[model samples]
Structures are given as C-alpha cells and as structure tokens.
Target: MSRIPTRHLGRYLLQGQLPRKGCLASSNYTPRGSCRVAASCSCSRCLQPFSPQATRAVHVSTSSAASPADTPIIPLRKKLKDEAKQLKKESRKNKAQKGSAQTVDGWELTVGIEIHAQLNTSRKLFSPAATSFNDEPNSHVALFDLSIPGSQPLFQPQTLIPALRAALALNCDIQPVSRFDRKHYFWWDQPSGYQITQYYEPLARNGSITLLARDGIAPEDGDSVTVGIQQIQLEQDTAKTLAQPGDARWLDFNRVGVPLIEIITRPEIHHPRTAAVLVRKIQLLLNAVDACVSGMETGGLRADVNVSVRRTGDTATGRLGTRTEVKNLSTIKAVEDAIIAERDRQIAQIEAGGSVVGETRGWTLGSKQTRRLRGKEGEVDYRYMPDPDLGPLLISEDLVRHIKESVAHLPDRELDELVDRYGVSAKDAVSLMALDNGARIEYFYNVVGGLGKRLREAEGRTPQQPLDLELDPDLKKYAPLAANWILHEFGRLVTDRSSPQDDETAFEITPEGQCARVPVASLSELLFHLHQKKITGKVAKELLLALYHGNVGEAGGVTAAIDAHDLWFHELSEEEYGALVESALEGEDRVLKEFGGNKKTYPQGKLMYLVGKMLRLGPTERIDPVNAEKAMRSRIEELCGTSA
Candidate 1:
C-alpha cells in the first residue's frame, strides 16, 4: 500500500525564486504551497506515482475479441464525428498533437471555481472538540460531531471573526441575518448522514477577487480581471475516512464540526492561469486574516474548478456550453494545471468532432489527467433543508463594526499602506507580507513603522502626494534597505529552520520564550546605520547575519552587534585610498605595460579582485562603498586616461 503525499507546511517557503508577483511560490511555495505530510500518514488522496515495490491493483481482462472504447457521455456533432474517426486512425501511426491552450480554433474557455477554506480556530464549530490536525484518529469528535442523542450544538462566536474578516477583505457584503441548512448525504464519513451549512441564507455575498492579467500586459502593472464572488457560506465540515494499515477504513472525526467557509466565484475567468491567480489571491487573503493556513496537503484549503467552452462569436449573454467540474484540486498549481488540462481535453474533443460532457472529474496527480468520478449533481440532489436543530444565525451590524475596527491594519490594508503610503511596488509589498503569520506580520509593520517615523522626522510631515513605486524618489532611500533585510534575510533565517508542522510557532517568541523573534529595536538600529551611510550594503548583510545568530549584546544595540561582529566599513583618506588603488596597477607588469602603453581596456576582473583585497578597511572603518566604488572607477579611468 502506498502512503499519501502531503505538504510539509512546517517550514515556510524562504528559498524559492520570486515570481512575477514577487511571491516566493517555489518548492514549499508560500503561494503554490507544497505538500507537508508526516511519514505516519497513509492517505492516498494525492495519488502520486508509487515505487515498483509498492502494492498497486491493476486489472487484466483476458478477452480475445476487440472491444469498443468507453462511450463518451456527451454526443458528438456530425462534422466532429468524422474528424474523430480520422484522428483515431492517425493516432495509431503518430501521437496526437496537443491543442494550443491560448486559442483552440476560436473556442473561448471560461471557468468558475468553488473553494473550501478551513478556519484556523481553536475548537470546531458548534462543538468543544479541538481542531488540531494529525491528532490520534477519532480523538477530537464531540457529542455533536458524533450526533449523539440529547447532544445539542453550541456555537463558537469567535470563529465568526475570521469569516467576516475574509468577507471584508474580498469586498463581500455581509448579511445581517443568515440561516443554516442541513444538506442530506449518506457518505460513511458523515456519522450524522447530513452536513450543516448555510445554503440559502449565507453569511455574505457579492464579493469579488481581482486577478492580474497574464497575456497582454505586465503582470504587476497590467489590467486586472475582476471575478465575481457568488457567496461565502459558513458551514460545518464532515469527518475524513482514512484507510488503516491493512484493508480496514476508519472515520477520523477530528475534522468533524470544523468551521469552513465556501467561496464560490462567478464564471468570469477566461484564461487557465487566471484561475490559479485568483486562488492564490484568496489563499493569501485567508492566510492574512488567519482564516485558514491554506495548507493543501493537510486539507486547510481546496478548490473545485468548472471549465467550459463556446464559439468565438458567443456573446457574454450567450447560453453557457457544457462544462466539466474537476474537483478536489489540492494546491494553487494543481488548480492551474488541472484547468489547463481540462480545457485542452475539451478542445481536443471538439476539434476531433466531439462535445464536452457535464460531469464531476477527479484530478490524479499520478497521471496528470482527470478521471470520471460521477455525474455532476444539481442542488436538488443534496436535499438541502433548513436545520430544525439550529436556529437562524443572527449577525448584528454592531458585531461587523466591532470586528472591522479591530483589524484596521489587516493584510489588505497593510498592502495598500505599502503601496500608496510608502511608495512600495504592489508586487514587492505582496512578497514582503502576503504569506507570513500574525507575529511576523507584527514584526513587519513595526519595521515599516520605524521607517515611517524616520521619514517624518526628516521631512517633518507626510509627502503631499502619493508616489507610484516606479516614480517614487524616496523609495531608494529607505524601503529597499529596510524591507530587503527584513523579508529576505530575516525570513530565510527563521523559516528555513522552522518545523514541518507549523511555521507560525517559529515566530511566537524568542528561544527563551521572552518575546517574538528579534525585537524591532535590533532592526531599527541596523537600518539607522545603513541610512546614515555609516555602513555599506555589504556591511548591512554582515550585520543581518549577526542578528540572525544572536551575536548582538543584550544591553548594546545594532552598534554593539556591529562591534561584536567587526563588520564596520572604514572611511579611507582620499590620499590613502588613491595610493592604495594605484598600487593595484603597479605590481603586475602585464597590467602596468597596458596602463602606460595604450591597452584599450585592462582585465577588469583581475585588477578589481586585487583592488577589493587592498581596500579591505578595518573593523571600525566606515567608508561608504557606494561612493568608494565610484571613486575607484574614476581613478581607473585616469590611470588609463591618455592611451599611455
């Protein structure tokens, strides 16, 4: 039996190359998150390829006669039917060519998505059972989760805040009064034979998520596509069925009664990559509000995308063609790849004279293809009804107001502050704050606050107008120096060494449990020195390493950290620096012959390598390398000035 593959969400993504959005979504990506599972887990939900030694079931039907292929559920057009026959015949001699995803004979691929986001609450909804993942199977089930006799569900009001925060961040309108419904189902995992959800009266509606356009413009500054949010409904999740070491399967109700918010998007998406962009946006938003960790391997968030196609001339009001629902995509990359694959599958069918069937398909990571699960069911199949046991959920305007007041500096607002207030690029701000947890976020803002204070002190007031990141004159002075050290340097030091279960714990407090990771003063002092031209970029990086290793003095500041590390850049006398540079050219006869004898250009690398060695200033030395490098270039030009 093959074990399931999952993301090791314990270590956050701190090493991947930054993408277009500046989000480090590479392996264990902060955005396209990697699977994080323990060796003990045996769930095969991901369906990754197994080893040759792994047990797998393969059926071999020994039939002598030729059999027909599985009949396509959706019928084909006469023109397409003939094309498909010819295609099948040609397939014997040559492999089928994959259709171009961007434009398949003028068929426009439109997509919609439904996402399930697990809330990061302490306890499950309507139950006192804990909601931690990977607990011993069946340990967290409450009486309500098990649907025991005389067991009444009691709501946890705190869970509502994350839901509401997501609604506001996604630009959704909150419902003053929402009600719960019982969705009838008979899955073995659901002990109650139904699920409690807000089917009719949801917590919010009319929200929208914006995706950066992929094709025609720069991803950062390009025109964006705004997808409509159908609704965000609050719901109670069902238990998971896990296979035992042998053939037995057990219900792990640890997930039962866990709070979930289902975000359904309107079919406003066209490109396959656009679907991924939207999912990433929501994932980060959920991460921002602490609504969900968005860990796909552990089932914190999952996406179901519906893809369809129509003729090029079809108008926006035209009836939508047949669509296939590819369900249970575990990560942002999975969502993107699945949608693209499905779209191509549909195009191949049509170009070969076939139509698409409306059905539910499951993405198999092992094959990178979608397999038929079952026919797509309509709302009537779920048998939704008002829950008699639970009363209508009442959300007062005052409650929304109160929660809104508390997180005024939430991620979206923080993103805007970095952009409009501090002149940071939209992409850079996202890279700086998007996937990090609350404590790291707190540390992030404190660093930004320190910069803001310094700016105010220098200018005496906020600048009169907002500066775009490209045109901003002041960004080079503060943002680059401050944000780079904090996000990249500090992030790598912490997340790279964090555990596989929870990266958030790494920022909880110092190793001594006194407070969170390095205090703001440490960073403030470091930035102050850099801003004061007392240290070069090289020295700043050395100081950052010192801070990471706890080399700073307890009572002493960044200056003390610097002294202890001997990372000072010394100011060299012009005469001393000039003679030092001249000496680099004097020793090598081949170079000296060139300097006096009209050599077009000296060996820049060899001479600079030696120049860099002699200019190695002492520990307390404080020469600004930015200016020193410029001065070195001028002196080199004078040495080679008169073609002799």
Candidate 2:
C-alpha cells in the first residue's frame, strides 16, 4: 500500500478537501484483534495503532503551499501610504468636479435638531433647591447638585407636569412606563460623573409638527412639511461652565440638577431656514402651553443640530451621509446660521473629495462659521445603565388624561384662530405669534376682547350675545387694525425701548401682563377710537407711543393721553374746511401755473402739495388726512374751473 506524505496530507486538509481514499488507510482493510486501531490502517508510518488519545493529539497544520515564502507582504507603513495616495487621488478628482454646476446642484441637505428646554418648574428635578434663570451662581445649589458622597437624589413630582404638558402639546405618545438611566461622562460641569436621563425609555415618542405655509416657515406659501419627533426625554441639566480669562474656568452648580426635557427630531428638515422656523414653532408651542421658559435668547431653550449632505439621487445605502452635530445653539438665528454653515461645510468637503467627519461643532457668531468642538460620542461611550437609585418612572393613565385635558391651545390652533376668526392676514398672524415668545399674541387677544366688550356695551347688548367680529362691520375693522398696531407699530416701540442707544438698558414691563408697557386696555381703547373715526391714524400712533412711555397720565386711559396731548381729531365744518382750502390756494401762483389748469392731467403731487399746505395752515394739527385731502381736491377743481 502507498502512504501519503505528511506535507501532502496537511495541504489537502488546509484546502478543505479530504485526502484520497487510500492516502491515509485503505477502506477495505481490517484491523487485527491486538492492534487496537479505531479502523483499518495501511501505512508505512503507522507504527502504532490509532487510539482516542492519539486522535486528540492530531493537530491541524498549514503547509508552505498555502502561503508561499515568495509571496509579497506589505508593511503597515507602506499600506497606510498607499491608502493616503488613494485618498489624495479621490480628493483631486472631487476638486476637479467641484466647480461643475451639476455637482453643486445635486447635493441635498438633511438636518435633525435636538432641543433641550429648561422646565418651568420651581424646584430642581431631584432636589429641593429653587430653579431660577439669573439667580446668584452658587446660591441655588443643593447638596445633591454638588454631588456630595452621602447625598441621594429625591425626585420632584411637580417637574413632570410641564414635561407632560410639552409632550401633549407636541402631540407625542406618552410612554406609560418610562425610566431613567445613568449616562456616564466626565466633565468639569458634571460633578456627579453621570447624568440622570431617560435613555433606555423616554417619556414620549412619535410626535409630529406640521409646518404650514401660513406659519411662514414653509418653503412656499401653499407648501407644508411635517417634521417628525423622534422622542422627548426628561433629564437633568448640567451646570454652566463659565470661561474666564486665561485657563480659569468656573462652574455654576445652580443650573446643575435643574429639570430639562430633551426633544429630538427626526432628520426630516432640509432647508436651513426651515430648521430655524421649526425651532421657532417649537418655542411658540412651548410658550403657549406654558411648558418651559421657551426663549432661546434667555438660555431657557438650547438646540443641537445634526446636519448631513448627500447627492440627490444617491441610494447606495438608503441612508444619509456622515453627520456633524452643532451643539449648544442658543438663538433661532444661530440655529439657522449653524445649519447653513455646517451644511455648506459638508457639501464643500464632499465635493473636494474629503469625507465629512462625524463630530461635534460649534457656531462662532462673529465669524458666522462652524468650528470643530469634539468628536461625536456613541451610545456605548455614554455607558448608559438603568438608574438603580431611581426606579421605573411609571405614569398613570389618569395623569396623562388630565394633562391632555389641561394642555392649552397649541400654536397652530392659535394661528388658525388668528387667521379665521380674527380677520388677520396669514403673514400678520405668524408675526404676531412669534413676537415676545407668543406674548404679543396674548396681548392681541386681550385687545380684541376689550374691543368686543366695548362694542357690546355700545350696542346695549349683553356679554352672552354672540357678537361675531366678522359680521359686525365696526368690530371687524378692529382685528386687522389691532394686529397691525401690535405687530408693526407696537413692535417698533418695544425695539426702540430695548435699544434706546448704543449702550442699551433692559426695559421693564408692568406686572399686569406682557403688554404692560403699553397697557392692553389703553391700546384697545386707542384702536377702538381709530376704528370709530373719533381719532385719526396719526393721532392714534402718537397716543400709542405716549402710552408705552407712561406719558399717558392716571385714570382716563387712551382718552386721557389724547386730551393731554391735544391729539383728538377735530371735524371741520364745511364752511371752515372751505375757508382753509381757499387760504392755501390764495397766493400760490406757481402751484396754479404748474398743476391747476390741466384737469385731464391732474398731478397727484400738486394735490398732495395743496393738502400739505392746508394741514400746516391748521393750528391744532388734528385734521384727518383723508378729510383734508378731499376738501383740498374739491377747492382745487373750483379754482381751475374744471374737475381737477
């Protein structure tokens, strides 16, 4: 019998093919009684029979044939060099195509926003310390906030109300059984070494906000987009780290352990402007529901935006490109600017054949650019674990129902009311709702309510009588007028007060309401008189300014301001109006020569000049412009002896 060489046997095994039938042993061979072989063996090298112990000793071996010594091997350094060369080649190709219009136009942007809103609760999430915005740095800190060794967190149930209200307002599905987890991290601001948050299970999920065209955030007037809410989780806010001169950094633990609700949105936003609008909408909604303090300018609301770009038709993985997160954006403008800067950065990187690194970035307002902050951390890096000290946060169905019932009118619904019921233009409605965190809208509503009450009293009707502002012509005029005054004129007043000079002082409002600077009652009365034609538009503006400045003295409201300033519109008798018009045209030969005789081409400028003359002629300066213009036109036609 022929025997196989050890090298040949090993080669065959390495190749995963069995050896030939007779290579090891003949199939028909029989073992002698004393041989003790497991099977038959016919080989010259088999001096001893195979035993179970010997079978175990058999080793799987590799032959030189599997990997020859002549095969070329690349060193790690050389391999890296080759990779760098390939990257450079790709980068060159991308740079060559970068200038192509097609390349620039084919890219699409995707953005996801994660907003952290400080809860409007009085106490901290897990401590008894009070929650405040501008309090003394360390004054509000509790022992737990400082992370003392013996301190344990005592959960505050009251903080859940605002969180639940926010979830409901956003139309999120509340999780009946949610829990908190410990997100492990080390930072100077985080004294506890781990943040208590809802990681494993969030408080709510699967919500959506529909950005309507009328909301002024949509791409076009009639187009609308729906942004999906991924989840809303409750967490503890980290302390504020103040960067001082040089390397000195101070931590304000007052903010530590403060309650926060983190709202994460799906990557549905495409435009930078749209992302900003969505953030503004969220602010409006939260403000309307009194959910959180809801002002990005005040650090009550902060956002982290994840932005990515890919070719329009690229479907290789049916997934987005690598994303970079812009963290801690504190303003709506900053949110928009950051997304734009990050989106452009990714596009430029990709077009230049460089890949977008998944990392964290920050917006430098001065430069209007996004700068690298740190590499993005993964879930494993956070080392999330169920919080042993705090058990599962079980929410009762009754509580949810109560919260749902208590949720105030959301921004969208308020917008609808403003447009449909209040006769405000869509543009005006959006502007009104966004002002002062929806406080302007509340002020507008109060003004309208006051107008309605005054109208009811004027008509000798009771409060129960349904007085539709749309149906009542006099009352209907007040809606748009009030909207204009609050949005444009009143807004200008606030801006002027807020920025009176280069070094501005913060303007304080009365405790009555947001419109306490110009009391709503005063504004309502002013608008009412304007609508009634009792005061001219010019007089109304003057009164509005006076009211805002507190120049309107005690008790009489708009009337008092009007009387003190002698701003009441006086109706001139026909004779008195004719005499004033006649006096303006008495000695104006140049005006008559240029504009009076040509009735076919009655110059509007000439008519306006005459009207201005008549206005200046009046001592009180309270004549209505419309009435003045009419009186002047009639007198001019008589003088020209044609219908001028």
Top model number, TM-score: 2
What lDDT would each prediction earn against the true structure?
Answer: 0.70, 0.78
Clashes of each: 18, 0
**Root mean square deviation (Cα) for candidate 2:** 26.8
Put down candidate 1 lDDT per residue, 1-644, tens digits, no spaces: 65422332211232221222322221223212223443343445323554577454322222322332332233335547888899888886453332234445677888999999998889888998898677788877889899998998888888888899888878788999998898987888788888889989999999986655422211422587788999999998888877888789887889889999999999988777667778777877777666787456567888999999887877566887799999989876788778878887887787789888889999977455678899888899899999887887888888888877765555556777776756566766776554443344455556655655655556665554333332445654676566666667766766666346445445443222223446676777778777866677777776666565566667777887677766666677787667666665455656534445555766566546545645664222554444555566677567656321
Q: Give the TM-score of candidate 2.
A: 0.73
Best by lDDT: 2
Any idea how many clashes model 2 has?
A: 0
What's model 1's overall lDDT? 0.70
> Cα RMSD (Å) per model?
19.0, 26.8
How many clashing pairs does model 1 include? 18
Q: Cα deviation in Å at residue 538, candidate 1?
A: 4.2
Q: In model 2, where do residues sit more than 4 Å from their true spots?
A: 1-104, 218-222, 315-317, 455-474, 497-516, 555-561, 572-623, 627-644
